[model samples]
Target: MKDLIKDVHENGVKSDYKEPKLYDVVPKEEIAEFEEVMREIIADIVSEASDVACWVYVQKYVKHKPLDDMLQEWSEASQFILAMDTWFERLMAD
Candidate 1:
C-alpha cells in the first residue's frame, strides 16, 4: 500500500500505463527471410523422409498395400515431427 501510494504521487495516479519495448530487436524482413529458409529446410526433410519411407514400405509389403497408404503414413509422420519441433520451440520461448 505504501509503495502504491508512493508510485501514484511520483509518477501518476493511473499506474496501468506501460512503456513499449523492442523485445526481440530483430528486423521484420530478416525474421521473414529466416522463416523462409527454415520452411525450405523442413520441406527438404519431409521429402527425404517420404522417399526413404517409400523404399522401406516396398521392401516390407506382404499383401501389397497401395502406394498412397505409405505416402500418407510418411506425410503424417513428418507432420508429427514438425509439430513436436514447434512445441519444443514454444516451450523454449517461455
Candidate 2:
C-alpha cells in the first residue's frame, strides 16, 4: 500500500516521462477522451475494490473495464494499470 501510494504520488499524471507515441495516431481530442475515461474507470475500480479479495476485485475490474487492445502499447497507461495491480495486491492481502 505504501509502495502504491508512493508510486502514484511520485509519478502523477503530469510527469517527466514522455507521453507514449501511441497518442500520435489518434486525434488529440480522442486521446484526451480516452485518458479521462480510463482514469475515471480506474479510480472507480480502486475505490470499489477496497474491501474485496484480489480475485473478486480483479473480476469486477476487468468486467467493468476490459483491457483495450489499443492501449496495449501505451506505456503511460500501462504504468497506471501496473500500479493499480500493486495497490490491489497489497489491499487484498489485508
**Which candidate number would show the highest lDDT if scored against the true structure?**
1
Angstrom error at residue 37, model 1: 0.2
Give lDDT tens digits, candidate 1, residues 14-91: 777577543355576687777788899999988876666445445335546454454465665655444444454466
lDDT, candidate 1, residue 78? 51
The positional error of residue 58 in candidate 1, measured at the CA in angstroms, is 0.4
Which residue segments of model 1 deviate by more than 4 Å? 1-27, 62-94
Q: Could you tell me which residue pairs clash in candidate 1?
A: none
Evaluate all candidate structures by whole-model CA lDDT and list the values in order: 0.62, 0.59
Clashing pairs in 2: none
Put down candidate 2 lDDT per residue, 1-94, tens digits, no spaces: 6776687798873446666685676777698788888899999877755533343345436655443532353445555555555676687689
**75 Cα displacement, candidate 2 (Å):** 33
